[model samples]
Each structure stands twice: as structure tokens, then as C-alpha cells.
Target: MLVMHTPPQHHIVILGAGFGGLRTALELEKRRARLKDFHVTLIDKRSEHVYTPLLYEVSTGALHDNQKFCVGELCSGVAVPLEAYPQAMRSKRLTFKRGEVTGIDPKKKEVHLKDGTRISYDDLVVALGSAVSTFGIPGVNEHALFMKCLADAFRVRQRLAEFLGAYVEGKEKRVEIVVGGAGPTGTETAAELGNFFDRLVKNGIIKRKDYEIRLVEAAPDILGIYPEKFRVHARARLETIGVILMTNTKILEVKKKQVVTDKGEINADVMIWSGGIRPLDVVKTFGLALDEKGWIPVEPSVLVKGQKDIWAIGDVAAFLDPKTGKRVPALAQATTKEASVVAENVTRRLERKRPMAFHPPSHWVTAIPLGGAYGLVDFGSWSLRGRLGYFVRKAADFFYFFSILPFGQAFRMWLKGTNVYIKND
Candidate 1:
């Protein structure tokens, strides 16, 4: 009789547990029964996965009923613990590892962690995401606050609270929060400050005139990527909230208390940068082709251009959308869809099946909350505005949490967030 031998189970490792990575994990977990030949390990520096859409909401403080959540409370609500994914926790093949990656040796198919541990993988997924881009602007790195993670949001709130207290004590005449971007995050953040400051005014904590939210943009219009109608509504809502719009104002430098712009210099008590993001430096060492922005260029199948078993997704992957003939935007909705492709492709390759192309929907539902009970949701061919739009926005948020979390937990989260957001008007 001929001697028989079994092949060792293949290992799949995913770096970063952001939207794409987490979604990919869930996708793989669902296919765990069929993926008996493989096992997946998700690695991240932080154990908790942040639900990023509500980030601006956390920054703006209590938007409804004049309530306020401390740094811990806000963070707890937005950041879901890795253990929350009960299905993934039950998957025998799926495992979570908490470690900061120090190096990647693609030739060896190994990932080096900071704690002197080395993990070898048969397949790798790089979804490490991106960080704020300062564009070599002087003082930006040293002076400006970023809004990338939970800690960053906490710091912003702390600084704003300190500024408010100083103003009330007559130590400062005015407190200016300069937001250096007009994208969805910056726009929503600036807009929502209306209700937060209004609550302060109502409580006699600070007068309306004591604080100013200055939203600066280098572009000619705010929400530059959205349709004109959406921009019009957003602009109208922002004006109603008393947010100062400084369009076509290029920030030459960011200082401790001032933002020097081509349009003029503005007095800033605090500068928050939501300007842009660039890929992490670790990708350069991955032996992958990086675009001009340092993002890894991936094929239509979402595989890293040069490697067979390596894939990249989310903010780190420069995936061109065939439908638009442009690179896909780094949105949570888009990332989840991309995760589906990566998961499916991995299994397909293993089974000697054909891989599918990366085709995302033309209209990923985007809801921009423009303060209070107002929001704008774009659904490709049509859009919704006002109360209905706000409802849809919250609903979209609901579905997202529901998709990743247990039904009961998902409902509780949605209820809590909706209750606070609905009463904002």
C-alpha cells in the first residue's frame, strides 16, 4: 500500500481591524465550514474596532436633549470591542491577535510583531488603513489636532472644554475652533457644533458669541464631491448653524493660535485637521506597487498587483472602480463590499475556482448629518433631505451595526444613537 500524507492547513493573516479587515473577517467566518483547509488570524494594535461614521458626532458632544457624554462614554459607544462579533468568536478557524506590526517580509511570507513574535502566513490581507496627511505643511504636524482615532477625539473634546472654561472665567475673550477641511467629516463636525454650543448657551455655561466654528476649505465649494443640490442644502444648514465658511482659503501654515491662509489670517484657539489621509509607511516595505499617494495598487480582483496570495483593501488599496473609471473612495460601505471580494477570491483561489472582479455599487448610500434633526442622504439617482433624510441616515447606521454585531446588541446601539440624534432638532 502506498503511504498517504495530509497537507498542513493554510494560514491567512489580516493586518488592521478597520472596516475592511473586520468585514473580511466576518465574511471568512461565514464561510468557515467550507474553509476547513484554511484558518484566519486578524491582527491589530488596538483590540476595539471603531465605528467611524459617528466620529464627528462624538466630537460635537451631546446633540440631543442637551446631554453630554464624557470621553470614556463616547468612546465606548463608537468603538466596538473585538469580542462583540459572537459569530466570529465561535468560529474555530478565526482568531484575533492584538499586536502592532513592525515589519512584513513578503518573500518569507512572514509578519513581524513588536513583541518579538513572528507569524507566517500562506495568504495575507493588508487593510492597515491610512492616517491624516499634512502635505508637508509647516506646523501642521506639530500644532494641528487629528481626528483619526478615539484618542484623537478625546483630546479634541478636552481642549475644547478647557477653552470653554477659560472663556467663562474671563481668561479668554473668544474661543475659535478652526476645522481645516470641508469634506464630510469636517463639514458635519462644524455643523453639529451648533447644537453643542446651543446647549451651553441654554445652560448659561457659555454665550453663543463666545465660541466660533470656522470651517476652512481650499476648494471653491464645500462638499465638493457631492451634487450641487446636496451642497446647497448643506451650505444652507451650515449657515443656519452659524458656521463660518472660508472657501478658496488655502492654509499656508497652522500655528498655535492662528491659521495663516492665502485669503487671510484667522485667529484659532484650536485647529482640527480632517484634511486628507495617506497610506501607512509599512506598505512601502511590502514589495508592492504604491501609487503616488503611497497607497498599494491592486488589480480588479483586489489582489496586490505583483503578488499572487497578497491582497489589499480599504484606505490602503488604490482600487480603480470599473464603473466610474476612477479609484474607489475609501468609505466604510465601499470597504465592506471590497471585503466580500477578497474573502470570496481567497476561497476561490484555494478551490481552483475562478476569482470574481471587484465591482462595487455606483451609489453607496452616503448620509451627511448637517446638525440637529437635519441630514442629507445620497442614493445615486435620487436623494433625500430634511427629517426624512435624517431618518434614512440613522437607519443606514442601524443596518451597518446590525450587519457586524448580534441582533440584540445592534438594536440597543441603534436605539441609543438614534434617541440622542433624533432630539437634536
Candidate 2:
């Protein structure tokens, strides 16, 4: 008699528990029964996960700091809720290990962690997001503040607070703050700072005429990628709030209290670098097929080229637009859509089925808040401003947090009268 032996269970390992990782984990839980033949493990270097899109609000104190919750806490509850149906869910697993991944051996199908642990897997997902790219500019990394992470946001707030306190205590009659970049992040940050300073002045903490806020952009106008209507309205709103707009200005260098631009040098007590972001250095170590700028090169389905059973998503993965042949913009909407597609692909691949294709086109939407009772919303063709836009923006922010937080906890927080305001410790 001949006997057939069952194959060893498949293992799915995911790296970087950002939006992509969290969404994938939740999808896996929903498909637990069918995925019993496989084990899923999610790995991330950080203990907590933050929604990067709303980070600017945190920096500007529009939302409370506590709004960002740790990823581990979020996942643990999710895993438990799906504990039933053990027979159908043989290997549903999630692991949160805080260690940097050093290298990947595609030949052996294993990942080398910095802590000397070798994790073998049948399939792998790379969702590690990009880091701030200084473009080899001088004094950017060391001097200018970034808004990438929670710590970075808090640091910016602290720095701003310190500068304000120092100005109030000293005899200096003038204060200047320069924001580098006019993208969504930089523009939003500059607007918030402008409002913050205005409040301080009105509250007698500082004098209105003594503060100067300048928003510098290398392009001809702010909100370069946004629609023209948005650009016009945003610039107008910013100017109305007493923000000095400087377009077509290239930053040459950043000094302790001055910003050297191509046109001329400007004195500034605070300089923020919100220019751009590049792939993390760790991607280089993988030696994967990468774009000219070091971002992972992937196919339409978000799979790494020339590497089977390996995939990439989020800002770290560069997908070409089929129509224009240009790289897709790194936006939260794009990343979330990619995550959903990746989850579906993973499930199909495990079931010996074909993966779905990902086709993303350029789109435009905005909800830029210009401080209290003011905001601008541009939905590609139409624009709205003032109170209606402000409420829409607030609701949008609330919905993002509401979707992520567990239903019960979210409802409890709501019942407790927390109005989407995250307080920082």
C-alpha cells in the first residue's frame, strides 16, 4: 500500500505594520477558515502604528495626541475576536517583534533580522514605508524638523513651543518662522502655525506685529499637485491668515537662525523640512529591482519583479501608470487601495488561484484646514470653503480614526465625549 504525506503548512510573513500591514492582518482574520492551511505573521520594528495622514494635525494641536494608538494593542484584540472555529483556523497567527530586518536571501526564502533571527517563509510582503529624503541637501537631517512619525510631530510642537516661550521672555521684538516646501504637509503645517501664533498674540502671550511666518516652495505655486482651484483657494486662505508665501525659491542651506535660499537669505528662528521622502536605506540592502530613486519596482499586481512569492506595497513600492507610464503618487488613498489588492492577491495565491490586477489613476481631493472655523475642500472640479468645509474636514478626520479603532472602544471613547481631539502627553 502506498501512503501520501500532507505537505508542511505554508507560512505568510509580512513586514512593516503600517497601513498595509494592519489591513492585511484584518483581511487574513476574516479569511481565517480558508487560510487554515497557512500561518500568517506580521512583523514591524515599531510597537505602535500611527495614521501618517493626520500627523500634521497632531503637530499643529488640532487633534489630541492620544488619538494614535499602538498597533500591537489594535491587533491583539482583533486576533482574539477570531479565536473561535479552531478546526477551520489552524494557523492564524500574528507576531509583533521590534527589530530591524537586515537582509533577505531570496534563494533560501528567509529574512535576516538585525537581532540574528532568521525567519523562513513561503511568501513575503514588504510594506515598509519611505523615510524623509533630504536630497543630499546640507543641514536638512540635522537641523530641520520633520513630520514623518509621532515623535517627529511632537518634536516639532515642542520646538515651536520653545521658540515662542523664548521669544516672549527675551526682548527680541520680532519672530520669524520659515516652512520649507509647499506640499500638502508643509502648507497645512504653515497654516496651523500661523493660527497658533495668532491665538498666542490675541491671548497676550505675544504681539501680532512681532511674528512673521513664511511658506517657501520651490515650485511656482503651493499645492502643486492639487487642482488649480484648490491651489488658488489654499493660497488665498493662507495669505488671509498672515502667512507670507514665497514661491520659486530654492533652499540652498539651513543655518541655526537663517534660511539661505537661491534668491536670498532669510532670518528664521524655526525651519521645517517637508520637501519630500525617499525609500528607506534598508531597501538598498535587499538588492531588489528598484527604481532610479531606490523605491521598489513592482508590477501591476504590486508584486516584486523577477521574484515570485514576494510582494511590495505602500509608498515603498513604485507602480507605473499604464496610461501615462509615470509612477503613481504616494498618497493614503493609493496606499489603502494597494493594501486591499495585496490582501486579495495573497489569499488567491495561497488557494492556487490567480491574483487580481491593480490599476490606479490620478485623482484629486482635499480637506485642508486653515485653523478654527475655516477649511478648504476641493473635489477635483468643485470647491467649498468656510464652515461647511471645516465640518467636512473634521468628519473626515473622525471617520479615519473611527475605522481603525475597535468598534466598542471607539464607541466608548465617543460616549466619554472625546470629540476626535487627541491629547498629547
Highest TM-score: give the candidate number: 1
lDDT of 2 by residue, 378-411 (tens): 7877888988997787677556546555656545
TM-score computed on alpha carbons, candidate 2: 0.87
Q: Give lDDT for model 1.
A: 0.81
Our tally of clashes for model 2 stands at 6
lDDT at residue 347 of model 2 (Cα atoms) = 82
Checking candidate 1 for backbone clashes, the offending pairs are none
Point out where model 1 deviates above 4 Å.
Answer: 1-7, 63-70, 83-89, 417-425
Shift of residue 251 alpha carbon in model 1, Å? 0.4
C-alpha lDDT (0 to 100) for residue 133 of candidate 2: 76
What shift in Å separates residue 377 of candidate 1 from its native position after superposition? 0.7
Q: Tell me the tens digit of each residue's lDDT in model 1 across 71-137.
A: 5566555777775453545676777888888888888788888888788888899999988888888
What lDDT score belongs to each candidate, Candidate 1 first?
0.81, 0.73
- Clash counts for the predictions, in order: 0, 6
